[model samples]
Target: MDDKKIVRAWIAYDWANSAFATTIMAAVMPIYFISVAGGTDGSWSFTQTAAAIVVALLSPLLGAIADHSGKKVLFLRVFTVIGAAASVGLAFVGPGDMWLASIIVVIGMVGFGAGNTFYDALLNDITSPEQREKVSSLGYAMGYLGGGLLLAVNLGMILGWESLGLPDKTAASQISFVSVGIWWFVFSLPLFKKIKDPQSTNKSRIGEHLKIGVQRLGETFSRLKKYPELLKFMVAYWFFFDGINTIIVMAASYGTTIGIEETDLITALLITQFIGFPATMLFGKLADRLGSKKMLYSSLVTYLIIVLLGYFMTSSLHFYLLACLVGLVQGGSQATSRAIFSKLIPPGKTAEFNGFLSFTSRFFSFGGPLVFGLVKLISDSSRIALLAVAFFFLMGILLLTFVNLAKGEKEAVQP
Candidate 1:
C-alpha cells in the first residue's frame, strides 16, 4: 500500500480502539466500578496498577519476538481481540462484583496497552520521519473525536436508560461496555485488512523466536549506553506520561470525592475530548514550525499549572476549566512524545525499541497512582495527592531539557 493509504488505515486503528480508552479506561468504567461494582476506595487505581504490571512484563519480550518474527500486525490483532472480548465480558459485572470487574479490567487493559506497543511501532513503517509529527498528531486528533463521540452517545444512553426501556442506569452502563467491544472490533477492520506487517530481518525459525527474543531484549538493555538520547527521552516520558495517565484514570473519582456530581464529571470529560480534537491538530502544526521539543516543554509547563489549579478546585466549574486545560495539552504532549521516540529508535529495531519504551513507561506508570493514593492516605486530602503529581511533570521537564533531538536522530541512523 502507498504511504497515504497506509497512514489512513493506521490512523483508523486509533479511532477504532479509543472507545475502550474513553468509555472503559477513562470515562465510564472507572465510575461504574466505584458506584455499581461496590469497589473499595483506591480499588480502581489498584486494578490499573495490576494491568500496567502485566503489560510491562509482556511488552519488551513480545516486541522482541515480533521484530524477529515479523508479526507486529498479528500481535496487534490478537491483543485487540483480547481487549474487545474483555470489554464484552464487562457486561456481566454487576453490584458487588468488584473482583470480577477488576479481573476483566486487567485483561482489557493488557489488551489495549499491549496492542498499542505494536500499533505504535507501525508508525515508522507507515510514514517517513518528516511526516511523523503531523501524522501522529492526526492519529490522536482522530482518536479524541472518535472516542468523544462514542462517549457522548453512551452518556446519553446511560442517563436516559429508563426512557430507552432499559431496566436502570446499570443496564445501560452494561450495554455501553458491550458497545465499546463491538465498536472497537468493527472499526478495527480497516487497519486489519489494509496494513501488512513489515518484513522480518532475522527470519529465525519459529522455535527459536522465544530464545532470540530474550537475547535481543538483553542486548538492547546492554547497549542502552549507545543511545543516550533515547534513554534520556524514555526516562522523561516515563515520569510525565505516568502523571498524565494517573490523572486520566483518577480524575472522575476525584471529582466525585470533591462533591461534584457524576453527570457533571462525565460532561466535563466530554468537553475535554472535543476540545482535544482541535487542539491536538493545532499542536501538530505548531510542533512542525516551532519544534517538537519546544512544544513538549510548553505542554509540560501547562500541565504543572493545571496540577496546581486542580489542588484548589472546589466546584464543578473549576473541574470544567481544568478539564479544558488538560484537553489543550494532553493529546499534543503525547503525540509529540511518540514522534520524538520514533525518531530516536533505530530503523530495523523499531518494535524492540518501542517495546523497551513501553516497558519503562508502563512499569513506572504505577508510581503516579501509587503516589496519589499514598498522599491521599497520609494526609486524607485528595488535593495534596493531586499536588504530588506536579513532581513528575517537573522532573519530566528537567529531564527533557537534556534531550538533543538532532543528535538523537543522527545516532538512530547509525548501523
Candidate 2:
C-alpha cells in the first residue's frame, strides 16, 4: 500500500478500537459495573488494577515474540478478537453479577491493553521520524473522534431506551456493550487487511519463539543502561501514563459512587468525546510547533490541576467541567509520550522495546488504581482517592525534566 493509505489504515485502527476505550473502559461499562452490576466502591478500581497486572505480565513476552516472528498484525488481530468477544460477554451481566462483570472486564482490558503493544510498535513501521508526532497525534485525535461518535450513538440509545422499546437503562447499557464489541471488531478490519505482517528469516515455532522472547526481554533490560535518555523518559512515562489511565478507567465509577446522576455522567463524558476530537488535533499541531516534550509538560500540569479540583467536586457540573479538562489533554499527553518514545528506540527493535515500555508502564500502572482503591477503601472518602493521582503527575514532571530529547535522539541513532 502507498504511504498515505498505510497511514490512513493505521489511523483507522485507533478509531475502530476506541469504541472500547471510550464506552467500555472509560464511560459506559464503568457506570454499569457500579450501579447495575452491584460493584462496590472499590471493585471497579480493583478490576482495573487486576487487568493492568495481567497485561503487564503478558505484553513484553507477546511483543518480543511478535517482533521475532514478524507477526505484529497477527498478534494484533488475535487480541482484538479476544477483547471484542469479552466485550460482547458483558451484555450477559446484570444486577448482582459483579463477579461476572469484573471477570469479563478484566478479560476485555487485557485484550485491549496487550493488543495495543503491537499497535504502538507498528507506529515505527508506518511513519517516518519527521512525521511521527503529527501521525501519533492524528491517531489519537481520530480515536477521540471515533470513540466519541459511537459514545454519542450509545448515549442516544441509553437515554432513549424507553422510546426504543428497551426494558430499562440496564438493558440499554447492555446493548451498548454489545455495540462496542461489534464496533471494535468491524472497524479493525481496515488495518488487518491493509497492514501486511513483516516476513522474518527467523521464523520459529511457538516454543522457540517463547524462548527467544525471554532472551530478548532479558537482553533489552540489560541494554537499557546504554540508552539512559530512553530509560529516563520511560520512567517519566510510567508515572504520568499511570495517572492518565487510572483517571480514564476510574472516573465514571467515581462519579457514580459519588452520587452523580447517570445521565449527567454519560453526558459529561460525551462532552469530553466531542471536545477531545478537535482539542487533540489542535494539541498535535501545537506539539509540531512547540515541541512534544513541552506539550507533554503542559498536559501533565493540566492533569495535576484536574486532580486537585476533583477533590472538591460535588455536582454534575463539576463532573462535566473535569471531563472537559480531561478531554483537552488526555490524548495529547499520551500521543506525545508515544511519539517521543518512538524516537528513542533503535531500529528493528520496535516491538520488543515497545513491549518493555508497555511492561513497565502497565506494571507500574497498577499502583495508581491500587492507591486510588486503597485510599478510597481506607479513608472512606472518594475525594481523597481522587487527590492521590496528583502525586504521579508531579513525579512525572520532575522526572521528565531530566530527559534531554536531543540527547535521546542522538543515542538512538548510535550503533
Candidate 3:
C-alpha cells in the first residue's frame, strides 16, 4: 500500500464532496431557497442542518459496519452516488416548490455528510501516524483549491444569469445545483479507482458485521474511559470545530442579514478557500516542527482574534480582511487537530474514535445557529453571533491546555 496513492484518493474525495459545501450549502442553495423558491424563513436552513445531524448520528454504526465488513470504499461509492443524484435533482425544483428544494437539499446533505465518515475513516488505514496531518491537510487544501475553481465558474454563470442562456435566475440556480452533482460524481470516480477497501480487522461475514455494528458501537461508547485523552480531545474538537463549522455556515448569512452584498460575500468565501490551500500546508509543516499542541493553540488564538475583529467589521473591505484572516488559520487548525487525534488513537479503533469524535463535533453544531439566531433576535445584531462563536474557541483552548500531547500518546498505545 503506497502512501501517495492513498493521499491522492483522500484528496480526491475532498474535492468531490466540496462541491456540496461550496456550491450547495455555502454558496447558491441558501440564496436560491430563500429568494427563488420563496422559503419564508430559516426552515430550509434548519432542515439542511437536520439532515447533516441525522447522518452524523448514524455515522458510528455505519463506520463500525464498514470496519467489520471491510466495506468503507463501497459505502463511499454508494453515498456519493446518492448525493450526486440529489444534487442533480435540485435543477428540477421549480417556482412554487420550496418544499421540493428543501427535500433535495436534505437528501444531498445526508449523502454528502454520511459519505464523509467512511472517507475520513479510510485515513486510518492509509497513512502512518507521523504522516496523518500532512496527508489530511493535503486533502483539505486540494478541496479548497478545486472547490474554489469550480465555484468561480458557477458564480460567474450565476451572477451573469441572462447571458448564460439559462431561463431565469431560478433556472440558473437549478443548473448550478446539477453541475455540482456532475462535478462531485465525476471527480469521485478517481478515488474509487485508486483506493481499495480498507482491510477489516474483524473476520465477520457481512450479515454478522451488520449485527456487530450495533454491538461495536455500544462497546465503543462503554470503553471511552480507556482513552481519556482521546475523549478529552473529542470534547475539545466538538467545541472548537463546531464553532468553525457554524461560523462558516452562518457568516455569509449573517452578512446578508445585515445588508452585505452577495457578490462580496461569495468572493470573500472564495478567497478564504483559496487562501486556505497553501496556508494549511504551511501550518502542517509548522505543526510538525513546533508540535501539534502549540500549532493548535496558535490557531485558536488566531480564531479568537478574527471573531473579535469581526465585531467591528461593518464594511465589505473589512469582511474581505476577515476572510483573509480565516484563510490563515481555518484549514491549518482543522488539519492539525485531525492529525493530532489520528496520532493519538489506537490503530484498530481509529474509526470508532473518529466516529465518536464526529458525532460529538456535529452535536455541537445545532446550537450555534440557534444561539446566533437568538442573538440576532434579542439584540437585533449579527455582531453578537460573531462574538458568540468565540466562546467555543475559549472553551476549546481551555480544554486543550489541559491536554499533554506526548503523554496522551504514550497512554493510548502503551502496549
For 1-415, candidate 2 gives per-residue lDDT tens digits of: 2399889999999998999988888777877888988997588878977887899889999888888899999999999999999999999998899999999999998989999999999999998988898999999999989999999999889889999999999999999999999999998998988899966787578999999999999999999999999999999898998899889867877887888997887788888877888888899899999999899999999999999888888899999999899989988888888999999998878989999999888777778888998998999998898898888899999999999999999999899
**TM-scores of all predicted structures:** 0.95, 0.92, 0.94
- In the order shown, the candidates' Cα RMSDs to the true structure are 1.9, 2.3, 2.0
Q: What's the distance in Å from true for residue 23, model 1?
A: 0.9
Q: Which candidate leads the pack in TM-score?
A: 1
Q: Please tell me which predicted candidate would have the highest lDDT against the true structure.
A: 1
CA lDDT of every candidate: 0.92, 0.90, 0.82
Off by over 4 Å in 3: 198-207
In model 3, what lDDT does residue 263 have? 82
Task: Flag regions of model 2 displaced more than 4 Å.
Answer: 34-38, 94-96, 253-259, 370-385
**Pairs of colliding residues, candidate 1:** none
Q: Once model 2 is optimally superposed onto the true structure by TM-score, how far is the C-alpha of residue 334 displaced, in angstroms?
A: 0.5
How well is each residue in 1-415 modelled by candidate 3, as lDDT tens digits?
A: 4468657877888888888888888888877788877886578766776787788787787887876677788988999999999999998887778888887888888888778887877777777777777788888888888888888888888778888777677777877888899999999987899888746576777788778888989998887787788778878888888778877877877777767898899899999999988998888888878888898999899989988998888889989999999998998888888888877777667666677677777877777777777887888878887798788889999998877777778877866
In candidate 3, position 151 carries an lDDT of 86
